[model samples]
Structure formats: structure tokens, C-alpha cells
Target: MANRTTRIDPAMIDRLADMAYLDRNPAAVRKRVEGMEHLLERLFVIPGINRPVGLDVILDLIPVVGGTVGAALGAWMAWEARNVGMSKFQMTRMMGNVGLDFLLGLIPFVGAVPDFFFRSNTRNLRIIRKHLDKHHPSTVVIEQ
Candidate 1:
């Protein structure tokens, strides 16, 4: 037998181009912010479900990679938020949270346990969301 790899659909590829700006990490900072904003919504809050499902499941549940992946993703979002006009202090605080999650998550069972309940990504998202809502209302959907 010969090894083979799966092929992506061309139509899907085209659709990706037509999609929103913030769907992926573009070169521009604003675009990156836009991407993270969209991801935050889809990843945490289920559309039309009136409930939020944030990064707790991904980071805390899995083994070593879980928390690391989630923390990195959240950090990316926070980084972009700064480009979207978030203040330095706010960005620093978000970075602090990311650092905390990564550092504490290094421990075997105990660290992973707290990461779940803490839900650092969700908290960081909320912080970024609030700042964007208050200042850059035109960029993101701001809710009370």
C-alpha cells in the first residue's frame, strides 16, 4: 500500500477568502484583532444559544498541550486587542493573566485542576471585549 494525504476542497479555499477579515492571522494588526474578536465569540459563546463556553474545557482538560495552547491563543487575542486601541495597562493585565495561567499550569495535577475553574481565557476575553466595547465601539459588538 502507498501512503496518501487528504486534499482540501478548492471551493472551501475560495470561501475562506470571501469570509470576514478577522478569520485568520493577517499581517495587519487590525486584521489580527478582528480575527481574534470573531474567534472569541465563536469559541466562547454559542450563537443564539444565550450561553458562553470559553477556554476552560480546552486548557484544563487536556494534558500538557491543553493549557499551553489555550493560553497562547488567548495571549494572541490580547496582543491584537492592543493594536485595536486597547490601553497599555489593559494589555499588561491581560498578559499577566496569560502568564499566570501558563506558569501555574506547569504543575502536574494541581495546576491543571485550577486552570479549569479559573477560566483565564474567558476572563481575558471579557476584559478585552469590555475595553473594545467602551472605547472602540465601532470595531466590536458591545453589550451591557
Candidate 2:
């Protein structure tokens, strides 16, 4: 029997570390929140009205548990905001948006309508981006 020694790449280790603790970096947090916001609010555009739609609307279309799931996702953004040292007032406003969206989404049949309009995740992402741009200027990326 022959024993083979495998070599591990240092770059791969660094990448793994980076992925493991992405939330610790302001830039990574910003990117993470932005991706989530995109998923929740603007995954695709509707053909006729040219409106962007995403998972928040789709999830809200489900019965009872849908609103709860959507709210939980929004709350996760709030958690990420806290990790970046957002002010309590900002947090309150963010949560309020989430809470309102959740309540509106609780309505039967029409729940998705409010989700389409309100977009709590996008609102929360805006709050996070504003904070990051102010406090961590280097993390700011110019949008083309």
C-alpha cells in the first residue's frame, strides 16, 4: 500500500477564512446585505409593467407561514445592520419597515400586493449602505 501526501493551498485557506467570517468586515457586510436585498426585492422585471419582482412577493403568496418567513429574513438584515454598528434609531426604523411589511403580508390574497410595493429589505439595505458610506468610506463602491 502506498500513502500519498496531499498539499493544501494557502490561498484556499485564506479564502475559506474570509468566507467564514465575512460578517466581520464592513465591505463584506454591505455586499451581503445588498445581495439579500436584491434577492428579496429585485430578482427580475415583470414584462408588461416593467416592474422588478423577487422572493418577498413570491413568499408572501404562500399561506400563514409566509409573512413570518419574510419578516424573519428582514430581521436578519436588521441583525447585520447591528453588526455594523448602526444607531438604535436606524435600527428602529428598519424594524418598523419589516414589521409593517409583515403585517401587510398577513392579509389573505392581497398580501403579495403590499410586498410588491413596500420592499422592506430594500429599505433596510438603504439604511445599511448609508451608514457604511458615512462610517466606512473605503467600503463604498461606485455604481455604474
Candidate 3:
């Protein structure tokens, strides 16, 4: 097979750069962080339920499929971090958090508690916020 070089459109590149810029805007970053927190709440916290169980932990009670689904959702946060220009080190650390959460969460009964507290999505969101704060200070929201 011959080597095929992929051609990228300049306009598309410009559009993506524009999107990255917008993503680093304070308002947009705040919205993204809020969305991540909401997702974390739904997955890790059950409303009015006395237990520490969330949908992800509850889902893990199923079998292999449950863990896979939870991991996929956790990975979404890392993807978002990448989109906003997180460093390779930060991205790797985020992946590690997700991986650790997924692995430990596989332990039948004992896994649930750890999964509830590990909160990889929340961790990844923090990493994204820190990256934005340092590299894209304009994106950091300041509340008086």
C-alpha cells in the first residue's frame, strides 16, 4: 500500500482554531465545567437516595457492559480536555485517573464505594480548568 498523505482544508483548520479559542473563553469554559459537573452528579450522586450509589456504580452491578459504559463516559472528560489544549502530561494524568477508576470499579461489591469517591470526571475537569487558567487565563472565571 502506498503512503497516502491526508489533505486538510485551510478553512477547516481556521474553523477549528476559532472553536478552540471560543472554548477557552471564560463564559464557554464555565459552561463546559458546569456541564461536566452536572454529568458527574448524575453519574455519581442519586437524588434523594440515602445511599452513595450513582448511575455509574449502579450500572457496574450489571457485568462487563456496565464497566465499559462507565469508562466511556469517564473518557469523555479527557476528550474535552484535549479539545481545549491540555498538555500531554495533563491528558495522560487524566487518562490515568479514568483508568484507575475503571479498574477498581470492576471489583464486584468493594468497587462501588471507590467508584463513588474516585470521581474521575470531576478530577479531569479540574485538570482542564487548571490548564485553562495557566495557558488561557482569559478563560478562567472570576467571581467576586
Best-fitting candidate, scored by TM-score? 2
Model 2 earns a TM-score of: 0.85
Candidate 1 structure quality by residue, lDDT tens digits, 6-122? 999999988878674444322344445445644533356547956554454445556678667867787887867765667788888888988888777767557765664565666
Q: In model 2, what is the error at residue 121, expressed in angstroms?
A: 1.0
Q: 90-123, model 3: which lDDT tens digit per residue? A: 9899889889978987887677678777777677
Candidates 1 and 3 compared by lDDT, better number? 3
Compute the lDDT for candidate 2. Answer: 0.91
RMSD of each: 8.7, 2.9, 6.8
Weakest lDDT window of 10 consecutive positions for candidate 2: 18-27
Error of 3 at 16 (Å): 11
lDDT of candidate model 3 versus the reference: 0.72
Full ranking by lDDT: 2, 3, 1
